[model samples]
Structure formats: structure tokens, C-alpha cells
Target: MSHHDEEIDAAGRADEFLQVFKKGAEFTQDLLKENERLRFRVVQLEETLKEKGHDTVDESPDAIELKKKIEVLEQEKEEILGQIKVVEEENQNFANRYIEIEEENNMLANLYIASYQLHSTLDFKEVLQIILEIVINLIGAEEFGVLLLDEKTNRLEPVASEGLVTSELPSVAVGEGIIGEAVHSGENYFIDSMEGYERDFEKPIVCIPLKIKEHVIGVIAIYKLFTQKDEFTNVDYELFTLLAGHAATAVFSSRMYSDSERKLSTIQGFIDLLTK
Candidate 1:
């Protein structure tokens, strides 16, 4: 080959190598720019997603309503608590009243039992005095009286008495005063705060009928001659009625024994006559 031809071939080869190196450098720069742009877009999308998620959390309606409901329920709970306190106080007062009533009932019942037992004795004077004392104790009175019916005269006689004058109602007929009505009518009478009667106008009076076999035979007079206004309760009635019934039994027994003794004496007299 010629020398000139060799030199031309060398120059052509060097130019081709430079052109290839320049194209590779430009391709590398383009690829770097595209990678930087993709990285920036991804960062922007991540920031947008974070903001959207924050807005959704802040706008939760259920959480806001729950907070409001909690506040309202707390106010209502306070109101109910006040109401419960009032109810508890009222219940305490009612329980106290119930206890008081029960105590009174027990006292009256015990009094009745003691009185009934005492009047079972056969001695007329002792029995009458014991019954009157029991009635006075139950009524809390300073004065009391008992009137017994005499079947022979159909009249009431004062068998027992406390704090009474011999002139004012010493002895009355079976159908005379308010007490007499109770004895004959077989009914009980209760009067409160009366005026202008034979005894104890300033106090309460309980008139009980002593009945045997449903027939009133005697009068039990209980005078609330001194007590506070409306102080004595109706429990006194229950006790008084029980005493009246027991007194009736005692009275009837005494009458029967007396009649039997009289008849036996008469029979003895007749035998004596026959023997003579």
C-alpha cells in the first residue's frame, strides 16, 4: 500500500472514535436528568397523600358527636344524682315513722295482757281495782273510774275510782251518762277535747262496753284527763276494747258464782226445815 493511503486511514479511524465517545456522554447526561425528575415527582405525590390523610382524620364527624354526647350525659348524671339524694332522705323519714307506730302498738298490747290477767281473781273489790289501775296506766291519766252494773236494780254503781268527787257522778243508772249508753248499747265510744261533761272535759275520754255473750254488762271509763293535743294515738282503742271484753268475762263469772251460792243456801234451808 502507499504511505498517503495509510495516513488517511488513520485519521478516519480517530474521527470515528471521537464521534462515538461524544454520543455516549450525551446519552448519560439525558438519563441522569430523567432520573432526577422522576425522584422529584415521587416526593411531591408522597407529600400530597400525607396532607389528604391529615384532613380526613381532622374531619371525623363520629368523634365530634361522641364528645358532645359524653358532655350531655355527664350533665344528666348530675341531675339524677341530686334526685337520688332526695329520695333517700324521704325514705329515712318513712322508716322512722313506721318504727314509732310499731313501738306504740307493742306497748298497748302488753298493757292489755297484764290487765286481763289481773282481773281474773274472784274477789270483786280486788278485781275492779286492778282493772281500773291498768286502764289508768295505759291511758296515762291521773284519774279513772269503773262502773259495774247491778242486775237487781238495773243500775251502774261506782266500784272503783280515782281522783273523783263523791257528788259528781258517784253512782249513775245503767242508762244515764255517755258511759251508761256504752254499757247498755254494747258499743264503744271515743271522744276527744270535749267540754261540760261529768268528768274530764279537758282530756280525751274512751268509753268501753263490757259485754258477756254479746250483752253489755258493765262500763269501763278511761279518761285522757291530761295529755297533749292529738298526742294519744288510736292504738289506745285496741287496748281498751280488749280490756272491756276481759272485764265482761270476770263480771259474768262473779254474777254466776253469787247466784249459785244463793241457790245452795236456799236448798240448805229447805232441808233444815224437812229435818225439823
Candidate 2:
């Protein structure tokens, strides 16, 4: 079933469980009050018998019957309490499961919103900035760069970067390093352990290649992550996969549009010069 459907189903079950718990608690409270009333009645009967000169109050038939009834009610109360404990544990488990499902739903919603914003603009700089925001806010990347492949030089050059010197970033040839290998093979590369990870300009901690079909267009190299982010989650991997295709298309399309605009401006300028 879908996660949304599962969440709804869980919510229904939790509501039903809560109703049962409420009823059980009320019944237990009633039993306690009844037991207390019966004990007070027994005490009153013993005092009356003593004043009437009856030395053996325990032997009185009314007293014996009332004591028996109180014992039975006490046993029932204990059993109900045990049942309530079991129900409480089950309810706690359900609550924990519900929280997990809710978190997953929230992550999915965030992914949808990020994907929509990525395609909402045709500006090349805006596309890159959107990607940077996704990585920093969503993936918790602290230092990263968006590198596009330079066809003329057969190298990947930095188009945008965060938490690092953009001008100082070196261009990497395809298949030369970790980022290069990801682009060359069109597969993601990441370290399994992020414990005590240090920054390496040449070797990033994680590399995600941006691909259009079978062709790799660029790479996202993450050198460091935020200190608070100890490890990557399943949603982080999903974001990387989404960026691989969507980010590539956005960047490529925006770059093409930018180039066309420049060409159109140049042609219009030439025509105006000829007319003058």
C-alpha cells in the first residue's frame, strides 16, 4: 500500500485503540470506587456489632459475605490493571510507528516541492542557485560545487560552488579522480563512513553525476557536510537521484537558452549597424 494509505490506516487503528483504553480506564476507576465503598460498609458493620456486645464480629454472616465480595472485586481490579498495562505498551508502539510514517511523508513532500522549484526558472544562474539550496538545506552539504563538462577541453569546470573558493576550484579531467570517475561511469560515489572526514579539494566525500539519458553532462562534488549531519539518510539518496536527471535537464536547457539570447542580441546589433 502507499505510505499515505498506510498512515490513514494506522491513524484509524490508533483511534480505536484509544477508545478501548479510555473505556478500560473508566471501568477500572469504577471498580476502585466500589471496592472502597464496600470496605467502608464492612468497617461500619464491625463497629455496630461491637457496640451490641458481639465479641466475634468476623463470624457474623453479613460480615463474611461482604469480605468475600471485596476479595473478588480486588482480584478483578488487579486483572484489569494488568490488561491495561499490556494495552498501554501496544498503544506506545503504535504511536512510534505513526511518527515514523509521518516523517517519511514530510520528506516526500519536501522532495516534490524542491523538484517543482528546480523547473520553475529558465535562468541559468537561478537553476544553479536552486540546486545549491537543495544540497545545502536538504542534503546538509556544507562545501560543494556544481561542475559542468567543458566539451572543448574535455574537463569538468566549476559553474557554481558553496562554502569554498570558486575561482580556486581546479578543473578536473573525466576519469581522473573520484568526481571524474562518477562522471565517466555515470554512477554515484560516496564514502561509507563520514566519521572524522576531512576536506580534500581533489577528492570530494561524495560525487553525484548529472546525466541526461546515457550521457553524463556534469557532476556535483560534495567535499564536506554540516557538523550536525553525522550521516546520510534514505531521502538524501533519493534527492541525489532526482538531481541526477532533473538538475541536468534544467542546467542544459537554461545554458542553451542563455546562448541563444546572446546570439540573437549579436545578430540584432549587426543588423542595426548595417542600417545606420
lDDT of each: 0.72, 0.92
Per-residue lDDT of candidate 2, residues 95-147 (tens digit) = 99999999899988998888898899999999999999999999999999999
For residues 141-190, what per-residue lDDT tens digits would candidate 1 score against the true structure?
55666777787998877666677642454565776678767776788877
Stretches off by above 4 angstroms in model 2 are 1-79, 266-276
Number of the top-ranking candidate, with lDDT as the measure: 2
lDDT against true structure, model 2 = 0.92
lDDT of 2 at 197: 74
TM-score of every candidate relative to the true structure:
0.57, 0.67
